[model samples]
Target chain A: MADVGDLVGRARDGEPRAVARLISLVEDAHPRLREVAAALTPYTGNAQVVGLTGPPGVGKSTSTSMLLTALRAEGRRVGVLAIDPSSPFSGGALLGDRIRMGEHATDPGVFIRSMATRGHLGGLAWATPQAVRVLDAAGFDVVLIETVGVGQSEVDVVRLADTTVVLLAPGMGDGIQAAKAGVLEIADVFVVNKADRDGADVTVRELEQLVSMTRREVRGRSWRQPVVRTVAAEGKGADAVVRALAGHRAWLEEHGELRRRRVARASGEVEAVAVQRLRAELGELRGGERLAQLAEAVVGRELDPYAAADALVAELRRG
Target chain B: MADVGDLVGRARDGEPRAVARLISLVEDAHPRLREVAAALTPYTGNAQVVGLTGPPGVGKSTSTSMLLTALRAEGRRVGVLAIDPSSPFSGGALLGDRIRMGEHATDPGVFIRSMATRGHLGGLAWATPQAVRVLDAAGFDVVLIETVGVGQSEVDVVRLADTTVVLLAPGMGDGIQAAKAGVLEIADVFVVNKADRDGADVTVRELEQLVSMTRREVRGRSWRQPVVRTVAAEGKGADAVVRALAGHRAWLEEHGELRRRRVARASGEVEAVAVQRLRAELGELRGGERLAQLAEAVVGRELDPYAAADALVAELRRG
Candidate 1:
């Protein structure tokens, strides 16, 4: 019930409660929260958003936690937005991800939050990026986003991250199928997580082959994607992963890809916000009578959906 | 080099070459395609868009072909939009789904086309609903959209379909995991495809339980969510699937959900078109400078993506 402006101001002034409240407000999809988000936008753009995605149970959470620790050890602030699939029946997230980050909860330099898909069709809960924006504005130096590894939609994390790391476990069936599905191309760096598992060598070989296949297709001569193997639980390969990330940042700079990615990221966010606004407006305009008539026409095969949509849009435009 | 308007006109006249040309024009992500699509919109709304989605190798294409056959047998004309994952290497779709419908290509009443995701970040290819509109205007009574089962983004099917059937194969790891992931809730009718496989009954029962759980959460009067078992290869349960669809149509009418779905569907199409248009325009206006700048800032860690995006939008507004 607090004024959103005041809440945003307090958050900018380092009030943790205000940051927490703003996150909840955005997550709830409250209309007023958009204004708060917009106000806080000016203060964002300081956090390094790293996307962590892989097939389910690939130790994505463990990797995220390890990264968080590494980031903190380097004397940098860290934020984690762990995305979990929601339970449709209860409309609540299992929230198991936060448990993985238990060590960092009490650390002032760390902020960890778990987000549910929240009925958004895409793997991302619509509010996930908005929440990320809030943290960035709050001065977090590193933001790690963990997606439920369901594939393509999960790759959307790339649009929001400065660097995207695709995690893969050893012995997953059909490695080519997974790569062919579009995940392989989105990775700035690949991590063969759970390397202690049997057949890790085989998975590594398959990933290398897939990467090679992708490299041949790329038009440019400069970009070289690297696949790194990691036993995330034991932290055996965390330093290499970090080094690969740093190398990617350097490559992005040398090639100017980082600038392009930032522009694309911005464009994506603006478009998302614009679409959400349009959907809300359209929903309000669809009065019961028009909807019922259109439904009847569709059921009776009297009108096609496209025609119905034209009529509705025409009506909206007229008003 | 023909104008898009001319191509769309030819497509409307049932010229296969024209239809194919128009689809290519749209897929090319050209600005003129919006005008061409707008011209085609008036003829759209007549086709019933049905969406088919499930995990890979669940036989979505086979099931789609069977449905098309049934609809054609009933003297209804059908249009098929099969969206294949783009080959990451070539940025072109393999378009092999037509193989599944090899039996129906020559049927006068059945029109089948395959669409590649075409670098669209979202699962449903950006050109999809527009292609469906073209098909609708071409006088197809039913439009079936088959999406690669990559999850979240594919769920966008529900936004585009009057009836959405989620296919599930028997023994797909954990049925409860699938159900809890929100796929169960999007389905109007649950299908246990590959019913001949072991654990079919178990999958069916788990789906029923999941649906019942959702029903309880909504606190609505108890109504059983129907599950149809189908071995799509042999067409053993195609008729039952058809009947279940009809039943869902009837239920929608009774509950007014059908009308609601139509409005939602129409609005969704409009939003898709509007967003696509806006993105194209934005792309042209940026002319690659803004994107390049943002991507660079991201790599340098000099700016956070969210803030950079907010700034870009501000800059765009100023321009």
Candidate 2:
């Protein structure tokens, strides 16, 4: 029941409870969510947002833990958002992941949260950017958005990041499948985890070849993606991965791609919010007799879906 | 391009090329999509929609083929919409499945199409029901919507069906995992495929228990979902599966749930079309300087995302 301003003040003062409360509001789509977002707006845009993603069994959780340790060793407060888009039903599929990160559970400098879509209206698109804003405003130096599975929604979530790290293991499929999944294009830094395994060199070579093949240029400057090798379970290659992240960040800044990326992300976030608002409006209109009648007519084959939609849109406009 | 009315007339006369062309228009979100939908509306509401979904390796393709043969034997035309929400990148992932169903390629009574989301604007939501309408209007007696994977999007696609069949194979996973994935609640009929394989009995029993434990009643009538056994590769138990589908359809009509379900489906179709229209309008607004300016303000932290969304929605209304 505390005021929004008080919560934001506490969150900025390193209070994890206050930070968690703000994100809970975002997740639940609380009525006062707009007020909270407005209150936290001025303090955001300071944290570096990085995205981590890969297919299942790629040790995404382990690699994320290693990165957390490496970042914390440098005295930087970190925020972690582990997103599970696949487990919309249980919302408990990530419990094992949270348990694996138990070492940092008690550290005040590290804050971790797992999010699921769970049949929400706008799904991840509506909640994720707001959660990132909350973490950024909470004074976290780095915000890592780690997602499970390599679906389109996962790619959309990772695209909100300034830098994206894609993890792959030796035996997990070939680099071709990853390319087919569109991960190769979104990855700013590629990590071949479990580098001590048998096929580690092959994975590294494949990723290097793939990255070299797909040359991308932004604003007349091209940044060749670097593929790093890591044994995340042993924490052997965390520093190198962190260095690659830093290099990509610096390159983005120098080329002015960072602001452009942020603007694009903001544009998507704004559009998702606007669409969600219109969806809500549509639901309200449905609560009345308008949508039901149109649906009845469509079911009766008296009105087509597009014509019904046109009528509904006209109603929405009239409102 | 030929006239949409001419295409609709050809489709009604069982010309597969016309049917294919109309569905292509739906998939591409063509400018004349509304004309096609409007033209096809009156002839719809006759085909029975059956949705089949489960995890991979469940022999969904084989079962669909078996059902196709069974329905063709009864002198009925059947249409199939195979949805691949996972392989959004490689639309070619389902090429093998399509080739597997090659026996029906020459049959005039059978029509098959595989659809992938592939970065579309409305995704499966906006395109699927319209595709179903196209098939329904093309004089197909039964429309089968078979979806790959058990993700939330797959569930949403299957919800458009009058009777939803959830396929499970022996040794795929336990019933608990299926329940956790939320497929247990959506099944009107459960098929335990590969029934000759080991553990098929246990899987069937587990599903029966799960179905019985979560009994659902609509309009004071309760229909217990039947779990059927099938060795789809050998074409065994296809009759039982077909019988189960008929029984469920009969029950749906007797309880008036058929009309209710169709109305709900129409409501969703209309809502998706409306939302797609609004999204297009938003895209137009984004092309102007208004959305870009608001996004810049959001990135600069001068205006929050919610406020930016409000401005965008206001602009959308003004349009």
Candidate 3:
């Protein structure tokens, strides 16, 4: 472990390697995380974190690359933290070139990092929020965190971004099934990607209605959610998607939501880490006599899981 | 707050209202869950819990309906837990009046239950496994737990079943996307539903290759993964799915994997409940001076979340 001061300084100086190292430290749960976070705090919160999530076979990666091009054209330094299933199959095929991700291979303004889930209960683990913090502090103007599927974990993933873009492809039979999947609640911007496909217009119309209905269902929201169309294979409609994101950002700031969202995001990250540590503490007790007895009691139905959990928490606290 | 004994007795008599009441008790986190579990324990371990899960719009409900017919024809009492995204559109359309689900509402041999995610991080949640206990103890011969998609939560959903079936439709390009989505690891049986559609053979071939590859990758599996094709809408190949599930169950029993899987499932349910209770305890601490101070410390980076979490857990213990 190098000096935190040097690493922070290098990261702030826009060194991709240094930025990557810092993110690694966070993901690896470095013992000095407190110091690292404290040191990086001054350099944080500038990046507009955007989350791109949808079902598989949707043009999530394609739309992402297209958005990357548009954002870069506008001269914004971008960072991407792709959650699992952003594999070479999805992104690399659309991204076309994965020679090397962060340095020496791609555009200088663009930085790409792929995250693989290590069988974590939530797809976005404790590491993702921390890693996002690293990218934020490293001065990425707009950081993109892309994940597949609109499941409960996607809701958590929304915590990593200020604006979340839900991508949908046309002719999936069930129009806007993304909303049905509970993603409508968390999405800020919806992208009907692969707009060149058949039934694109119908999909767009359905999304318009779904977005409005959901927006009304969720009361007191000052910002209206917008649906944008994209055909990322040829990069058409990519600029509109970027514009929509920026518009939402502006709306967030105008309504004093940006700071509030950041606070919520930070608290969420804090709570996630807290839960992770407690789980770790529990795992640490697995081989011990206490957990075994407690598990036995639970499995035997002599004690319900909640009651046994209370006893286990009490025992862990004693330690 | 009624007598736990009375509730259990009524639930055991196959009363729909009693069954629904028992499930509600679990979902609402009833304080009497301990006694309820103890009462139900004697009747469990008899039901064959098969999990059917896959992407949305894969005809899960249609397949489930067909399975109910086949299982009922075999004189088996079946329970279905459709875990979310089982839209009324599918169940009611293909099912033709989802009034009470599956073969003329008054059928006693089939019980259909749908579990919705109530903002739980994982789609399955604590209520699900406990509800499964309620159903199992109610003497359902086969409990089919169906969930949608391959999110992290779906992985958790797999723990609730002895055999997990992965359903995929053909022409959803990249024949093995299900494998890529982390479904392969949790799948024991693969069903390429909508087999009458074009490219069905291609999808089956791809899944066959994927199953073998994954089997080898996983290592030490005594039973082989099988791919079954079905056009669930017309009830085509429904018996084969039922047979495949039975075969998997038989293999599990012969290899002594069934008992192991049950133990694993019970332990997993225990762990999830414990974690949920701990989280609830933590949530209860919010707005208190201690939690506020700790959250402030973490957000301010004065203390890492791990240390703050330790203090919070210790405080909970003291209380």
Candidate 4:
């Protein structure tokens, strides 16, 4: 097997196969993939990652495909990481959403890949941001990350994106569900996909009410998020969506929001990477023995879990 | 107005008022309360923290009340922390599930306290295990933690408990939802609560099938997770639930699982405490001018969040 460094080098040389292989290595949880990804981080600041999230059947894939097509037409290279929620029972079965974007897959200008949640607690597939890094370092102008609609954790995607577009379906619910899930605050742009559906206007009105209420709560924020309606399948509102995104890009540039977002993204990436390292190093040294002993003790009830965890950490630190 | 140390002292001296005050202090997120609780951990090993988690309205509160009644009847003192999901609109709301357990509140032998999740990501209220530690140190024979049921992240409760009872309601969409949520694996004992409802037997059969399938997939030495049917409102099958818990306890004891459990609990608690300390320290230091500038940079998009976090941590270490 080629070492991670070699794969990363090939990826930096703009080899798609090398980039794909590197991502697979990281996704498979190879021990040295982190170092390779970290080495490439300095070269990764150029690509703007846009996260597209929404409920299933809300045309997130279609919207993404349209956006990819538009970006390609504009002579910019694009990469799509379509995140699918894994089937809990048969972990092997993936809800392959890329099939919907089949038209773009064959385009040399657009690179699309599907990622399963792999049963991780937080929504974005664990390997997602790393894959984005690979694409970014390989000089993609834009990388789009589409998440499977698992409510709150979906908010996590915002940490990984320059801009987040929350796709909404008309006639879904009273918008209370979205509010309850904390989706309203995280969305940079709200897209009412499937605009041809009934209640699109109502949905937009409700969303506007939500935005107004948010403004009332937050106050003094000049950038009021715009809600755009689009029939993604017919591609009627694709330009508006693209325009709204471009407007956001301009706003970020005008207000120095891009630099701030890059900092936030970099800080989040470092923290995540650090935490993963800490957990792995600590786990390797003591996790197996401590877990076995702790599981047995928990089963026996002689000591409580809190105490066991304390002992494990203490031991790890002592070592 | 009494300090946490004083309250801990009073509670240790068998004063219920002091114990209640100590619990309140912990719940309020007072920094001193953690120190007081840690001082009391050595005296808390005797109480068994039992975690109850399941889907919303699965009668977890009712089951908890019934189990409290049973334990009280056996002359065991019990502490109940009923965690409710907080309303996103209001940060403060009534922790009012006590109405369901009204019969036990004034029983003297049963101490029932309602807790709100308070925007914590984990299902159990963040203050839950701390409160459990307070109860344990106060001489309660058992501490019961009833989580706000969102299904995911309830696994955090496993780290806080000696035994985990997963409650399931009849006709909850064919048990697929339960399996999908990954609740079935963490359960030490499965209680088909609300057995009086129709399709109870079918739910039990379905659960059995799912559990069996999981066992086959993992294929190792596994304990047969016993399922008990309960009509908690009527107090039927409450004895069976207790017996099942007791049986698991015995199994753990015979196989030396108790010691292992104790270690695990201790280790988990220690890690949580360390993380809490890190967060507190970081929050304090981030109030400085340099960190403020860094935050501005992050907000401006010049620095990524990952790098900002890294710098913040580095600055803290320097201090």
- Report the number of the highest-TM-score candidate: 2
Model 1 share of native interface contacts: 0.11
Interface RMSD of 4: 6.3
Q: Where does model 4 sit among the CAPRI classes?
A: incorrect
Cα lDDT tens digits, model 4, B1-319, are: 7765677788877677888888777667664654675567557668877888775567777788789888888999888876654433221222445775778756767777776554443224246766787898888888888764442333465446778888888876637666765667677788998898999988899888888877522224466778889999899998998898888777666766666666565555444554444444455674645555665664444554446556766655565
Give the top-scoring candidate (DockQ): 2
Clashing pairs in 3: B54-B149
lDDT of 3 by residue, B233-284 (tens): 8888988988898898888887777766776676667667667766666766
Report lDDT per candidate. Answer: 0.68, 0.87, 0.72, 0.67
lDDT value for model 1: 0.68
The interface RMSD value for candidate 3 stands at 5.1
What DockQ does candidate 3 score?
Answer: 0.25
Q: Give the per-residue Cα lDDT of candidate 3 at B239.
A: 87
Reference-based lDDT, residue B223, model 3: 63
Per-residue error (Å), model 2, residue A169: 2.1
TM-score of candidate 2 on Cα atoms, chains taken together: 0.96
lDDT winner: 2
